[model samples]
Target: MTRPDANPAPDADAARLAALGYTSEFRRDMSLWANFSLGFTYLSPVVGIYTLFAVSLALGGPPMFWSLAVVGAGQFLVALVFGEIVSQYPLAGGVYPWARRLWGRRWAWMTGWVYLVALLVTIASVSYGAGPFLARLLGFEAGPASTTGCALAVIAVALALNLAGTKWLAWAAIIGFSAELLGALVVGGWLLIAERHHGLGVLFDAFGAGSGSGYLGAFLAAGLIGIFQYYGFEACGDVAEEVPDPTRRIPKAMRMTIYIGGAAAMFVCLALLLAVEDYGAVIGGADTDPVTTVLTEAFGPVGMKVVLGIVLISFVSCALSLQAAASRLLYSYARDGMIAGSRLLRTFLPHRHVPPYTLAVAAAVPALVVLCSLLSTDALTKIISFATLGIYLGFQMVVLAALRARLKGWRPSGAFTLGRWGLPVTIGALVYGVLAIATMAWPRTPEAPWYDDYIVALSGAVVIGLGVLYLVTARPYERGDAPAGDAVPGGPAAAGTAPSSEPSTRRRP
Candidate 1:
């Protein structure tokens, strides 16, 4: 529970990085608020709730609101586990570097690959989700062409801001966090106070929405709202090298992202559910877009447009944060010479404090995924399904690795740790991750094509299989000269005063 320094010295941050077997390549300019904002924006309650609200309600009725709290509690455990890991490691790539130090090079390589792919897909998913909002904000009809065009445009703008520097990224995240939180509060508060049509008792009413196995199946299916809303917290750790006193600050920011982001999401979902004028229309498939209908009825066209503008900002910010995290993970991989074109990918632009090549890949891959949506109508759905599943799988891998390390006597030596609760928290996180993954990957679309029904599981298997194939064939880990495994003798606790072995080559501005 030690407080992080308000403004830790650059030398201290550099020394910590060097102690972990790396130089200070990224500019440690992000403040505590900025770091929290990055994770908050990536979580993007506005985007997650707005996109999934109708689906969740249709699947589990008013009781679906409980899923937010359920997933939040579960993910908070995961966040606690992650906080301890990142506190000790405080590495740039988040999960990848933590896994490397906790486990080994092969484990780290696969973890990074799975996580990198998930981040890229999430970028595409967020960008694509923004298309309709952007198109509507511009007074245009949202169609395949318009949506795809807008999605690509969003990617370009986010990429431009990211390439500007960590400063611009921080600014964007702060702005996005402000706008999204304010919008959610204003809208949710308005609906609750002025537009609520249903009584509080309605939340317990199943309203005949679940299948034969009862509401449990439906509630679990609707759990994606909470599962997806809680993760962007890890993005805080993804930029650890860019934040001063990261070992102390990043852990707090991760927890803050979950607590604040979860509350905002619950507020939005609750307001939307209670404001629905016709629950039957939503649950019975008569009204496909209840969010827009309710907002339009309450706010009229002009006010609804304004809200859509806010939602669009949330989406853009989400995509931007995802891109930033993706670039950092790629940079981390290349820094260790673990991928093709390592030199160029790891090239740091001291002036901008950004990895330009990796940034391009981050933007380009998502853009390609967005474009692929043009070929098949279900492509985006499949991509989104896989994205969520892939993220959860990658997270569990890290949690599992941490547990293994702990059992082998790897005590966390950082500012923030669970102490006596480490094992229990790690176990809870792993269990939660496993159940959540099963819920997400379960085949629900029995009527659709077999591939569509099993998209989440199949896509995940394919991605992991491909990563294994490449790892075995390319043997990138063996060729890398960079330090691997636990480089620090006794963890970061011993790093603060340790003399820096790898001094930074670039001049600071």
Candidate 2:
């Protein structure tokens, strides 16, 4: 956690970046904690648990909380692999830049395409989920229409803060992280200490009440909650360029975010599950939300409302971090002329160091998606499942790409490295990723509508399919005439230069 290298000067930082084939353009204004807070807030335990806890409990009973532990262990493997890549490349777009650096422009383009869609949809999903909590806090009926309205409002405010400067977002994330952490510990601990509705063994009870995917099937279904909750840790690497000493700090931040955030998530979820007073009513009754029932029973209505108010802080901060990460992805792609309107997206506000067009795109897409909630919240929920699946796919793609690169004799020499442990670690992460995606995508619910069951996989396939179509048709050429680096040892001549034995040996004409 110590400053990896004695606070390198701006010139030295710029030089380090040049070795990786990029110029330091943005304002490196974020401090160490702020950098760490970005990932922590994005992976907000409060938001994840409040939104998905009830759904998981219903699917697989209290035993569903076990999946949280399983997913956390898998994702920690993922974070380690990401740490190596981010430390070496350290680009604005976390996945995109790493993919492009390791492979080619085409691979990078697809990575950006899929990840950007995932982030935007996630913003919309997070916003829609927040609507009910906010409406309840404000004493309004949280109908479809009202929730959609609230989501749009949140999108606008988050975009504004992102466009202003790092200072605004830094403080917002700090406050949100602090509040969410304290709220989880205090609230979760109180529920365990004061109210003991069920024993600890309840977490292992497989309530195979559902017709589809009996006990084990429902357990897999419940894994969706943990898979969705763990991803925001990657948000740290998304803004790596803006953080000081990114090579050292961002990797550490990435791992700690998962460690601390994942633990908090598991603790809160276990506490809430153990506090469930009646499994039959909360899990099987018509038109019941377990979160609402448990909160009201444990803390009374007034206290529940107060807790919901704190949850709003989490929702708002999540929206802000997601939007920021998405915009950076856009800017990273556009800077290399990979996407349309690249000129505009590449433009950054001189003083603010913010890419206005990218931020606008980030907010606008989510706003449009939120509009769908007006039709049917149920329909929107099915569609939002795509967000979780898509993100997992993106993460897996990077892991696979890294493993492939490693097999081809690509050694990771970042400030952080796995050395001999790289191959096994990446392989383990990929196995977990593949299983998680397949489980979610499988059509296990025969009683439910077909569209609902296959929605996640179908939608993700469509998005990736579209990216493939663009790649084949446009046949996009690699842009930027910068000097090459050793991303690939014996690959194509990068940047209008002859192939060389070493990537960094090639200099500009």
The alpha-carbon deviation from the true structure for residue 156 of candidate 1, after best TM-score superposition, in angstroms, is 0.9
Computed on alpha carbons, the lDDT of every model, listed in order, comes to: 0.86, 0.81
In the range 230-275, model 2's lDDT, one tens digit per residue, is: 9887888888878888888888888889999999999999888878
lDDT comparing candidate 2 with the true structure: 0.81
Residue 135, model 1, lDDT: 89
lDDT, candidate 1, 1-509, per-residue tens: 54454655888888777777678668888999999999999999998988778778888888988888988999999999999988888888898888887877788899999999999999998898889888888999988889999999999999999999999999999999999999999999999998999988988997888856678888888777777777899999999999988888999999999999999998898899889988888889999889989898889999998999889989999999999999999988887778888878888777998999999999999999999898877555566778999899889999999998898788888889888999999999999899999999998768888988888899999999999999999987665444455533454321123323553322111
Question: Where in model 1 is the C-alpha error above 4 Å?
Answer: 3-7, 487-509
Which pairs clash inside model 2?
A: 485-503, 486-503
Best by lDDT: 1
**Ten residues in sequence with the least summed lDDT for candidate 1:** 491-500
